[model samples]
Target: MMRTFPFGTAALLMLFCSIVSGAWLGLHPAAQKQADLTFWTFTKIHYDPYTETIPTFEQQHHCKVDLQLVDTRAVTSRLQAAMLSDVDVPDLVEIPIDFAPAFFRGPLEHVGFIDLTQRIHQAGLWDKMVQARFAPYTSRGHIFGLPHDVHPVQLAYRSDIFAQEGVDVSKIKTWDDFIRIGRKLTIPNKRYMLELYDFRSAHLEACMFQRGGGYFDPQGHCIFDNDIGVQTMLWFVPLVAGPHKIAGSIGSGQILTQAVEDGYFLCLVCPDWRSKSIEKDIPRMAGKMKLMPLPAVTANSRHTSTWGGTMLGITRHCKNPDLAWQLALHLYLNKKELGKRYEGTNILPALRAAWSEPSFSQPRPYWCNQPIGALYAKLAPDVPFQYTSPFIATAKDKLGEALVACVQYYNANGDNGFEPFVRATLKEKADQVRALAARNPY
Candidate 1:
């Protein structure tokens, strides 16, 4: 028999002790010489340009930065606990786009994060940043964090496969066009036009985002089950389950990579990270792969949306906010540092100024000489900016549940009952999220 502690008890206890120990070191005023900053991060970047810049930053400021890498799933809970306990808080940390909403639920001052508005204005960085990327980290007219990467969404397709199937990629200007082309390309159990298994809710979210539908409206009300949302689902369900059957279910992780390599799906709606992974994993796809702006809901609609990203933030508990801000500014605003990070990870930089670097416009031999970075740079600004609410985490979980339920129902009963079932379930989930948000815990 094994006993389990609550989610972050052990980690929080250790962090609290570390903070207490550090405080003890400050008992003598004469012993305090320079400030020490702790930085926590989830993704372990072995060759981070930010890490390289730290030596020079420390030399100039006479400070030391301790970079701590932790499990990705534990970050949000740990940060919340540190805020409540007021101990062992990191001076700097990275927060994912989706998680940013949850952290921004309340007043910025109460959230244990320093407001970066004045600092940004002082640095004259307003025009230098990707303006659209600012929305996710802003709440109630307060800016809490700085963007790290731009994850613009696009359609990655197999040009060879589409041509072989007698489908013209350029004719796919809308979802209807995609459906038409997809129907022709799908070969029952043999191949498909798109992947539907692991990314079902994500696909729906992308479509919703593209059509200007989000989990909440600007006033922080749940509107994910609006007319536009229902319309998107009605249009989306058939592609996955009906006679059009354009999508095939693929498992997560290695199975997905294997499916793509074997040509099980001709196209996938993805962001910058996935596109990069494809080039790295299947180098043989050289001239066969091509990227296009995501097919619009209508010919006149917007062409693209965003998917995943992260931002850097400074904690209010930091002993040296000035030094922490300096370090963060260096990491995000330094063109040389951002360019290096982009080269190593293929993560599209959130600094708008970085798009003009010569490297960003270069063609990739792995992508049929496509200027992948340049294309994403063009799409980045077009991504619709939307508000994310504190209840986004809850809404995300409920939306996923609804998606899974609807997918199973559609597979079992076919198209006859899908539209109504999906509509009703999604509406119910949206209502639940609205109720949660109305409580005003913030």
Candidate 2:
């Protein structure tokens, strides 16, 4: 026995109820109209670029993007948790090369990431992006991420020290030459020709990569005990051991800063990103550093190696994959935005077209007035394709342990046993990784 309202009265009552519900829920008209997107990244260095483009994109797409900056470790932990819980997941995330392979190793449909293969091909981005940057993010037959930068490895030497030591860069073209010059620069206890941070064997790996060797082949098989790898280990063993130590380990943080500032290292193996950090950390060493192509394994090696990079990926939780892809493209694929990112962060653009910018040609006084960008540009195209499997991160740890152990053995025994020991250790580690890969899915 309810009283029925007239047509106009009922319509007015319904509208009033809608307004009340909206107000109660704290949902304004503008808020309801905007599509919200969440982006998680490890660095706020990307904020400026996002600030520039996101607003424009929001206006055009009627979407609001919220960027969350988190710690590197936190990014992976949170991403994994969110995926597991299926709640509070970001629409986009930045994955590094070292961690990307693990994610990409699984089937694309089963992983938390979206497959970007068709979109990349259709947008013509496949040809425009740095080809080598795609390696770590490709799995099975699908590409899962868009490359954010090219991290070509280079040798940054103290120019003043090299000149003082009569170590001519032009003549030291091969690894043998580099080692000879390094031996000459060694002064027993006070200083060494190079420095090693107590991190992973990035320096050694960079050398191995330049020699066309890596932890695994493109087919995801371990090849670290191959001829090239054996040769690399043989060379690395002596440099870190005995009375003829050309490289000394400097633990990270303030000690590393102090070492670099105190001029304990004549040369440092640097990636493009590392070059930026040197300028930021050891400002006192300004104008003393210089960039050179990596010392080749052979006199005629045509390629260089790369280290450390990031890739922008869309998560499976994205409500609008199309828009998320658009945002990623705006941030990284657009030449203008790429140029801005480079200017702001010294992030070497993965887009080949962006390399022609005038800044790439400009000389910087920070590195003895070297055209750093141009040199990196030349090296970028030649960076060899490096592949990693899911076991890569653990494999790196094992390899580092082997490296430390080899150095300790030599330092203790003073015997010519390091090469054989390193070879055996590398083989053992390779077997471990292979067995792990076989047992693990994908």
Candidate 3:
């Protein structure tokens, strides 16, 4: 009775059951898992724009995104640690120009960021973007990140104060003319012509860039003691110290805003982003400020400089690089998205195609209806190229030290032998930088 069923029949029965199961499973397939991506930015303002726009990317790609807002110092530290440990890393990150050099310290193949040069060219974006803006994110001829903005610097002056003092800023084409007119407006501690922090090198760096001078040459060699560097430092020291002082330290935060309100400073070195900050921080300054091209070192020199900058790059650990690259293109190259960001940040897009957005040409009441965006766009093409290196920050700090020393020398010795002293001081600083570079050859 137990052997009653034939062997062939039993085998056929089992095969039929397996076929049925396979067909049924094919009709009701398992759900596909959704992809996940994480993004990190150092500033909340930078994070907000992506938050508003990333939903579109998620819907199209059928993925989820997690956005993080980390502080500047923490962002740098966490990124470095993650790169070293290969754990808990974001797929995409926003790197400030000041922090970009550190990531480039390693050999090309070992760099944390993906090499995007071929992708950029393949996407036809290499020619679509402002070519000079890529300098900060490039290393050894390999591009790693897409530039975030063209931070062209200009002169933001209190138009009301300038008019009241009968100073014609239009004639101020060169630094000499600026100083001549500034002398009449400068009143020592009461009111100063402009702001130049003696202890900080930002303003000085901008001026040097304007004259096509910087901490390092294109070959990544230290050139802080070159002719252009020496000339800029000599001209800059007298304005912040000695008898020719026409600049003052206006501090920051409430102190800066209060100084603007109290007319403690007449002019400021305004980059594109700083204009927006001025709008938000000092609301009462609306319609009272006007922008002009920065006075050049010479009539033939560039009239504009650059200040802060940022870039977005895909990390080497990204699980979905294709998706990340698409997202970057959406955030940086799409005119509508860039327009939305510019409305809040007043940053000029590095993508040349986005410059034609109406938002850029719109006259805002905050800046005396000056079409602030248009003004910056005119200078964007001329913004100088800034080279990056691991020693750039250190070189800048050394220049700051040299500035302090030169100021001290001017204060005690006046203008006598000032050039020689500055030359010697900068040479000594340059030598120190060379020594450090030798110890850490990259």
Candidate 4:
């Protein structure tokens, strides 16, 4: 071949092979490669809805999607490690509200999430979405994620219990009224008006946020020990402790459902998602439960607070951010999917336009035929902003510790000097948070 092979013959054979390969490829287009996108989420509830739309998305974009359900506790740490190591990073991820601040710890330019400010504004989403929802995902005027829900919190009460006791929930408009009426209804450890925990800060945090106080200000500075905080603690400590206690502790999951079945607590802090969970977990209690606005500190105070939330964000390492953004929109803003989600999860959409979904107006038999979606939607505008910081988790832990100390002090010394002790304890915690912030300085 080296001595006698002709270049023209070799060239002709190569051309024929190329033509055959082209013809084969034309006949079997399915063999062509597609751009692959990897997505990670923490729960099946968050993952299942996409099953309806992913096929359409793949077909339209000519891409493949690989959705992975990761454990909530492990997802954030794994994401951080993958991003830091620059290997096996997902193109899209769902970040829980509690875990969001962890990704925002470093300098703005170095944040793991891609800056989405320009894109959101360009797409007109900045105005189309609920404005308050952006507070948790924004950093230095840059937005990193799109909100997944409004999560407005309301008070879900056992109407049957209230009616049996001849109590009218309508007359109770303030926290003071709630406590006073609760005192008459509560029967020591046998039954309680509501649930709170001296060892946890969730209920306390919700109440504080309702009162326009939270762990951090808009500037990401710690303000957990502010005047409102002290006053909230002073009012809250007696509800779960002391001689005038009107609350009990009912842990979450099946324990919570069982407690409701046994009538352990008459009222629960019902965020929109919690309502759906209750409906699914104990379907028989549908007619017994009803929704009402959270009792306010003042007549003008906001009637609702936000609880749990999640957001969809694109990673900086994503090879195709434009595609990821499109996918996020497909999942989050599609009215049909949003309506379906509302029907299934009772989670209000953050997009204002989606509020008009017929599902929002339909009376849900699960909530005693109350238009629960409309109820949550009515208070959606008033839900408080949840500002975030890298120190927020730490602040929450410290707040829980302060709550415990205050409860113990009240138990030992009574309400005679409870206010001052609460103030001092909150001040110490605030100082501790400030010290940590000073060291980190983000």
In model 2, which regions exceed 4 Å deviation? 1-35, 197-199, 413-415
Tens-place lDDT digits, model 2, residues 1-442: 1245456776878887999998987754445324478998887777656777778778888888988787888888788889889988899999777877776655657888998999999988889988888877777767888998888988888898788777779887877788888888788777888875434577778778888888878877878878888787777867878778788777766777788777788878888888878888878888999989887877788446888888889999999898898888878867776766676677788899998888777788889889898899998988877777878897787777767777777778765676788789888877877888888666
Candidate 3 residue 326 Cα shift, in angstroms, is: 0.7
Give the clashing residue pairs of candidate 4, or none.
none
lDDT for position 189 in model 1:
86
Reference-based TM-score of each model: 0.87, 0.88, 0.91, 0.91
Better of 2 and 3 by TM-score: 3
lDDT for residue 215 in candidate 1, whole number 0-100: 72
Model 3 gets an lDDT of 0.88
- RMSD in angstroms between candidate 4 and the native structure over all alpha carbons: 8.6
Give the alpha carbon lDDT tens digit for every residue of 1-442 in model 3. 2255566777877877899999999998987534487888898778888889999988988888888898888888999999999988889999899898788777888889999999999988878888889888888789998898999999999999988888888889999999999898888889899988898789988988998888887667888799989999998999999877999796898899999989998899999999988898989998899999999888877889999899898999999999889888888988988987898999999998788899999999987899989899999999998987778788889999999999999999988999999999999999998998888656
lDDT-sorted candidate list, best first: 3, 4, 2, 1
Per-residue lDDT over 330-351 for candidate 4, one digit per residue giving the tens place of the 0 to 100 score: 9888988898888877999899
**Poorest 10 consecutive residues by lDDT, candidate 3:** 1-10
- The lowest-lDDT stretch of 10 consecutive residues in candidate 2 is 26-35
Residue 187 error, candidate 1, Å: 1.1
* lDDT at position 49, candidate 4: 80
TM-score of 3: 0.91
